[model samples]
Target: MGYLALFAVGVTKFLLGKNKNEQIAMDWRKNAVQVFRQEFDHVGCNSDAQSLALMQRSYSEYEYFASGRQNVFYAEANLSLRKRHCLFTTLLFDLTSQTEDLVQFNIPLNLPKNMPLEFLVCRRKDLKGRVSKLTNPGNFIKNPNSKHFKLSEAEASSKNSLMVLAEHDEISNNLIDQEVGLVLAKYGSLINLIHVTDLKQYNNFPLFLRAELQLTSESEEAQYTLLGLMLRLADNVAAYRMSQTVVQKCEKSRKQQKQEEQMQVKQAQ
Candidate 1:
């Protein structure tokens, strides 16, 4: 059979019948407890929820929550194979803020500060405007506090020179630049892990650096890497907000806690 057919058969087999699917899905709910763990009693990926809750493809988004200084950050993605996303990664970070979406900065290995680095600023078209120079430091790159999600892939874990190929590879997503953007710069630290995208629909959430894996490779590293990034992002964002920010912080709201407990009731029904 074809790949698509094989995938469907695999899912059906894994899920079994509707009754059995519910059992498996319920297990997802139980494991949904933590998308990422916390060092302290009240931090980490406090929640890990899959779309199987509703079993709807439209809702096939994974909601991984990380506590921030002020609010909860959600790292979402759809692992559905039906979607024709090349390499099939649709990771997005929801800060749950109103920050307007802008620029999709495709980073390079070595980024110098103050020099002209081609930045695809906020302008939606046929991906027009061959650009140069990064003006908005907040978006392109920002000075991080002592705390930031250590993106290992961008550095070593995913192998050194991880970004050496990113500039050349096509990130197949609507929010990414159709073409690569590289330029010179000066006085910029290597925040090479993340690239900003303009795909704003989920409340001004900034998508973070994804763990890119080969489409042909069936290794679970991609999943692990994606989750790791989510956790790191959660840590970085939460830490940044608490330290550099003054707004409200994510404190494991009572409502959220109750909802998690309610999941057990939901499974019973």
Candidate 2:
């Protein structure tokens, strides 16, 4: 009777352990679902059906957040699932503006310690132009501000270079002609003119009106007025085209010079 009681107690202990393990597994699955839903909501997944499909395919297992820690867990399983579906696992933390001053957070987690990362600080509008300037400083310094002027001075101290103006807008023929003459006198290069052809009906109204009036048998007086307007437009278009060609040629020359310099440096090295 003593041996049988001992055996029954051992069996009860085994069953209790198994039940506890099962409960833990259930909790993990539930937590994983919750975490995925929260992340999905944070990322605005509802707006896109494709994103929702990605989430469904990528959410797999919930690894224990941390040993003995209920709050944190490894998103490794979900990340792997996402990778299989060609989806990026981006973790975005909601940080308040004041949080940076108060909290310490690890940057670029999971990346190699030796990996190089570049941070660019600038107004959003200046990003493209600043990048272009870094490649070709002389051509980029058309309107120099205090910051750029300092940069220009540094460049000048290092190398003798000429500053060139950016291509002029050619929406108006008269403006193009004026810019072309100025460029020729200053830089002695053909200026490239950029004529933007706006396709909107309202934008082309003046030209369209003249063409229609001329084609219609409205009156001899109307015909004469329309013809004069058409002649003026033709002259404007011709002038714009010529200026554009000149500017393009100048730009080509500048590019060729830049290429030659690069080749010279390569040869010297």
Candidate 3:
């Protein structure tokens, strides 16, 4: 009789322990997503209680949020010291009402409130898998050797020369440093450095081809056009800076040439 009573107590203790562990796991997951949403401001429709509730619920445990043309799936998992937030979105065709392939989007963090969120769609599964690693897209340009570029120290340090760094290639940093060092030796402060990551290799279609198709008068054209316009603006800014530098160089060269000619006439006299 005593043995039976002890067995009952042991079983009760075992069940309680299991329940406690489960609760701890659940609490940890909830806290994680909450922190992520707060940090990234990933919440949708701040004014709508229903939308907020739906987002919380969906993000609570790998669920989908759909409204009209947009569909988003939220997934959260604990990794090391942080809880990773992964959200995937797909746009459904308004005419055919078919869901498109999953399009990768960006979750903006550590930026001004008015700054627009930036997103990129890549076909690379590995890149998609590493979305969590991209906590800051703005800093990607600052770090020449970021996963988005294959730049050498030399190329990265060039003051004003535009450098193209292929993200997917394995280029030696030492070589880049050497080349940039050589440029610095000649043009001390006249070098401009630029790093561009072409994600076309990760896309289903060639980037130019996809861009051409996107320009077609389709419903998604507006989004594509906006993206193109942003890229164009960045290019324009870079070109303007380059043009100013070239003009300065030309003016300096003309002054030097005139001085040399005067010196030659003086020697003749």
Candidate 4:
């Protein structure tokens, strides 16, 4: 009788803990969406779906909130670009060996078809761990050493805390100029990585400028600033044109990727 009673108590405690954790996650999601909505409104973005309230689980331990196709008609750029993003808030317990849960915000902007470059910039400390976590069609590089050129001196500061890489030198030079570097340096600690690439597994956009931010606080002001920076990055990317040589290279790479994907499907059958 005592053993059965102890088992019942254990089960009750587990249930209570699970409920408590879920409540905390819900609260955080609420606050995050509120802040995000404010930024989207300021930028004249219409949340077509407002899908943050919908929860999805890719695996038992991972859960995320996705915003579906926030359309922004930029009269300034004369382009209609779409914003799609996901927030991965606090992993479930025992999902990883880490002691603390971290919140990640991933924002990707759909790019025009003419852009033919891939770019990645992040703090040196985050490079290895961040690359390891990126899975599947989301993965950026076949081999980091050969595929990516490390632009260690790009930021031009003794205290440079960034590790920059791009498929083309032109992309690294054009995108990471003084203004962009200042925004990145200001919020360097909060940023995990920002990259532009055409290799997303689910290729809706020919390319995308994606930023992954690690939210450490509930300050809407800071979040707004970071969000604004992302907008600036997208605008700058839209304005820049790739050289013909690089464009040809990117087109070749895309063709090869399609061929490999077709081969994999055939093998599966």
Best by lDDT: 4
Q: Candidate 1, residues 1-269: lDDT per residue as tens digits?
A: 69998677655544443333343334333333344333112322334222223233332222222233222333333222222121222222223322211111111121121111111212112112211221222222211211212233333233222222111111111112211111101101212234332222122343333322111123233333433333443333223312112111112232354576589799999
lDDT to native, each model: 0.27, 0.29, 0.29, 0.51
> Which lDDT tens digits does candidate 2 get at residues 83-181?
111112111222212111010101111211111111111222333553453323333324222222122354433322223222232323242244332
Worst 10 residues of 4 by lDDT: 77-86
Highest TM-score against the true fold, candidate: 4
lDDT of 3 by residue, 1-269 (tens): 99898678666655664454344334433433343343233433245322322222222122212122111122222111101121111112323353221112221111111111112222222233334433233222222342332335665454432332221112213223433333333332221221222222323211111111111122333333332332332222222222344345434544565687689899999
TM-score of candidate 2 against the unseen true structure: 0.20
Where does candidate 2 have its weakest 10-residue lDDT segment? 98-107
**Candidate 3 least-lDDT 10 residues:** 206-215
Q: In model 3, how large is the Cα lDDT of residue 244? A: 43
- Candidate 3 ranges beyond 4 A from true positions: 39-73, 76-269
Whole-model lDDT, model 1: 0.27
**Candidate 4: where is the Cα deviation over 4 Å?**
1-108, 129-160, 218-220, 252-269
Candidate 2 segments whose C-alpha is farther than 4 A from its true place:
1-129, 133-137, 141-165, 169-245, 252-256
